[model samples]
Target: MPGTIAFVGDSLTAAGRWDEWLPEFTVSNHAAGGATTADVLAEVDVVLANRPDAYVLLIGTNDLAWRKSVEHVVRNVESILATVHKHEPSTRMLVQSVLPREPEFAASIRDINRHLWQYSSTVRAQFLDLWPVLADENGALSPVHSEDGLHLTAAGYELWLDALRPAIERLFAVPTTTTPIDVLSDAISVSGLR
Candidate 1:
């Protein structure tokens, strides 16, 4: 069974009905519309207080919108992850790629995503590359996914959920006994046999 989860990001995250969508787990949305990485850093403590079993992060786009350098966004994100890891080493983390926007932002977004993917490994977090699923041939947020090329439509959210659900499940999945002896022991216990 899934445990508590915290979703942290900007408008894209703030708009999600995570509790309704992920009824299996306790959900907390710590996102705010127009929020930048610095903004997330300021309010990260509130999210930590929830003590969620996992964290799903999706920031940086707003920072891009504000013309913040890729390094600025990446550094802030690293700080967020480091702070969370320091406070809750056992908590799992899922770092999502910054969704595509206008074509001009595509390259920078990819750079941010790559850095985040690498950084996630350092913090032992899983990275979800949403680009292939969300971007169009021109490397912009597909119109099918977003009307404004930034926020998602219902269909977009559906695609995201399709990817996100499995990742979350894997993050919380209990390891099964693979050894023959352990399997036999489990079977015996289940069958009420000595």
Candidate 2:
């Protein structure tokens, strides 16, 4: 049996709809519109409670959209990661880079993602970059992959599904096999599980 995979993020990850992309694994989504890093921390409990084997996290567009400080955003993300560690240590979390915003907001989004990727590199979990697949030569979100300047359209989601396919495939081979919900229960008993 394979472990359950869950996606926990803001609109981009949620909008891409991972379910439509990978049909092989059991998947659950905890994405919501207008969610910032703080919002993510607020709802993370729901995701941990489900305890999927893997988690894909994309957030912070709203935070940048609101002109929140970079330090504040990073702090919130650090908090979220810490929570994930304490509650579900066994669950491997993917820290997804924040997508480039439209013309006006692109720079800040890039800054936020830069920090996220850097943090992911140093952390125990993984940081998956959705930037290249979604960005055009100008470093703006490609029109083909976006519904608006932000959310992904169908083609955009297809591109996302493809970019993440390898990671999803790797989930099947994880030695510990169980339904995602059960895995969380088992994970809770271990130390360092957030």
lDDT of each: 0.88, 0.74
Cα lDDT of candidate 2 equals 0.74
Best by TM-score: 1
Model 2 quality (TM-score): 0.81
Cα shift from native, residue 48, model 2 (Å): 0.7
Q: Over 4 Å off in model 1, which ranges?
A: 174-194
Per-residue lDDT over 107-180 for candidate 2, one digit per residue giving the tens place of the 0 to 100 score:
76678778877776443567778888788766677778775778877887777777777655554444432234
Give each model a TM-score. Answer: 0.88, 0.81
Residues forming the 10-long window of minimal summed lDDT in candidate 1:
174-183
Residue clash pairs of candidate 2: 85-194, 86-193, 86-194, 87-193, 87-194, 88-193, 88-194, 89-193
| lDDT (Cα, tens digit) per residue for candidate 1, span 1-194 | 76899999999999999999999899989999999999989987888887788889999999998999999999999999888766666678888999999999999999999999999878778889999989998889788899999999999999999999998888777342223445666899999997
Model 2 ranges with Cα > 4 A deviation:
170-194
